[model samples]
Target: MWAKLVPGKAVATPVISYMLNKAFTYLVNYWRTEDMESVKAELLKMLPHVQAVFDAVDWDNIKEQSAALDAWLWQLRDAVEEAEDSLDELDYHRLKEEVKARDEQEASGSVSKLKGKLIRKLTKHVPKNGMLKRLKESVEGLHKALLV
Candidate 1:
């Protein structure tokens, strides 16, 4: 159902959790079954409402920042592809090993490790003035979503 609609990533986790829990609770409590048609209709309605809310949020550079991030990711992907294309067999294996070690470390950096790093990063990046208030609002949102 959610796959058919678009919502801000900020709201996505909460909305998915809420809907899943609600639907599961309903089924368990009443032993009722649901059809996809009804779910699809609900999803259709939700998409527009979500669009409206996000549209109303006048973020100055959020879109530009997200696009820049996307561009950087694309550049990284292209560089990796180009490097792969240029690699000779022995060099490819060496690069593969290097990548494998990095990937392994990344895989080991679980949610707890990520959170610790994030806290340290926030301490470094977060400025005073209204920025902290905005940060607090963002944290409050995730907290209410049971995500942070």
Candidate 2:
């Protein structure tokens, strides 16, 4: 599937995107109920948007790449949330450290090639309030830094 969608030859986003799509699809499919249709519709809408994001990236597919990374992070967040212990101070701090590492890599252009996907992945986990908000804010800060 990725051989053609991704321009300038094969790269990581396609691999990551392929995986993200599959994982998200699987999770949604597994847990989905009466609201499944709406959720899928929304995800369908995101396809072109994700594509447009790829277009804007120009090269190295930063948006798409980062987006993939972000997706992975969110999965982690969800997993953490589901755990009996939840995100304790130590865990939260570790996540922060990870985010910081990502931001640093982004700032130095280490992951610049994959920024759009990166941002997409980073922002997708925001849960609307509380602990999620703090995480969202941190990711947003990283997103802003990428633009600079």
Candidate 3:
């Protein structure tokens, strides 16, 4: 079977690593509520370990094993996509709540000056629930691959 190639050029390594770093950072920095504590902890733990593994890769010599590297990169990509999907589920819920809150405020007979205040809050990056177990498993799988 043909393996999908990863762009392992000198420039692409840094860019690829940067994208992974950004995704990990976003998950780590996300605000957490009580219900999210466990999931947040899992993400916080997994991301740094994954980052360390990614950081330790010999990017310059990667082309020597292009086939193997391609396989590994594809696995990483799949794991990253799964993580993003899981996080997006939480974002969906957070947005739904924001919209509901805004509607409620608009329906209330508040002061004229305060009419739009709630809507303004909706624009804020409300730090945000997704399948924690699935996300954890996907990341852990990537982590195991990195170990090899």
Cα error, candidate 1, residue 1 (Å) = 32
Mind giving the per-residue lDDT tens digits that candidate 1 earns over 1-148? 2122223545643453454344333333333334333543454345444445345543444445476434433343343233233223223444665565456557765875576556544543222334323322332232232210
Query: Which tens-of-lDDT digit does each residue in 47-76 have in candidate 2?
Result: 454445445544444346676644543443
lDDT of 3 by residue, 1-148 (tens): 2122333333433443444444454445552334444543454455565555455556556556476765675677676566566656655766886777667777867674275675556555444323444544544554555555
- Give the alpha-carbon lDDT of every model: 0.40, 0.42, 0.53
- TM-score (C-alpha) between model 1 and the true structure: 0.20
Report per-prediction Cα RMSD to one decimal: 19.8, 18.8, 7.2
lDDT of 2 at 115: 72
Q: How much is the lDDT of residue 104 in candidate 1?
A: 56
Quick one: ranking by lDDT, best first? 3, 2, 1
Candidate 1 or 2, higher lDDT? Answer: 2
Q: List the residue pairs that clash in candidate 3.
A: 90-129
- TM-scores for all candidates: the values are 0.20, 0.26, 0.45
